[model samples]
Target: MSLLFYSCNSQKKAQKKEAETHKVIQKKYADLLNVSTTEIKNVRLYAFIEEWTGTPYKYGGLSKSGIDCSGFCNVLYNQVYQKELPRTTKDIAKQLDKVKQSRLEEGDLVLFNIEGKKNAHVGVYLQNNMFVHASTSKGVIISSLENPYYKKAYNKGGKV
Candidate 1:
């Protein structure tokens, strides 16, 4: 009886800790995305973003120390959605069905044409016009679609 009681107590404690961690993660990402905590679903996605946030950007790089836009998206899609993505931005764009910016949903791809190049950049859509990417200057960061730079460079949203 004592063993069973202890097991139940330990299980409860573990569950409580997990719930607390989920709340913390939701709060953190909600603040980043400028939304309420309740809107921040997909705890795994946010947790993954939090873990990789601030990683340095490197051309053709694919590790935590350095990652590029497509690489970041690749890692994100693979880990979060269990989906495999093409290695390059252009290739990834090729494989996706184009989605309008206003129609984008969570886990959709946001393609960009920076500097007048087609499909030159990519990011993973979160919500409320916010997407996460490894920017050339900012490394891993969350950015808004409404930003002037992205606005002009915006190509289209994409989905698998």
Candidate 2:
């Protein structure tokens, strides 16, 4: 009877600790993204994006040192969604369900036509119209879909 009580107590403590840790993570992301912590529905995904915030961009690269837009998307999907994706923007786009930009949700892929090529660039959409991508000149950064440059280059959004 004593052991049962102890087991229940220990489980309760563990759950409490987990809740507290989740709160901390929520607060951290809320501050970083400038939104309410309650708006953060997926803490692990938020943390994953935060982890690569400042990585540099490199064509055909796939690590912290450098990563292209599609490479970053591939890594994100593989790690956060446990799904493997095609390595190139065109290929990735082919695998995803086409979605209108107005309907984009978190984790959706935003396509761009920077060089007039179909799906020339890709970024992972986050909440609030923001998306993270490996910019050729600025490396990895978050930009708004409303940005004039992106607006002009916008192609579509995709859901895997």
Model 1 spans > 4 angstroms off: 1-8
Per-residue lDDT, model 2, residue 146, is: 85
CA lDDT scores, all candidates in order: 0.93, 0.88
lDDT of model 2, residue 109: 91
Residue 15: error of model 2 in Å? 8.9
lDDT, residue 47, candidate 1: 88
Over the stretch 38-155, how does candidate 2's per-residue lDDT look in tens digits?
A: 9988877877877898899999999999999999999998999999889999897788799888888888999998876888899999877888899999888888888999999998
- The lDDT leader among the candidates is 1
| Candidate 2: residue 73 Cα off by (Å) | 0.4
Pairs of residues clashing in candidate 1: none
lDDT for each residue of candidate 1 in 1-160, tens digit (9 for 90 to 100):
9999999999999999989999999998888888999999899999899899999999999999999999999999999999999999889888989888898998999999988799999999999899999999989999999999999999989798
Give the lDDT of residue 158 in candidate 2. Answer: 78
Q: TM-scores across all candidates?
A: 0.92, 0.82
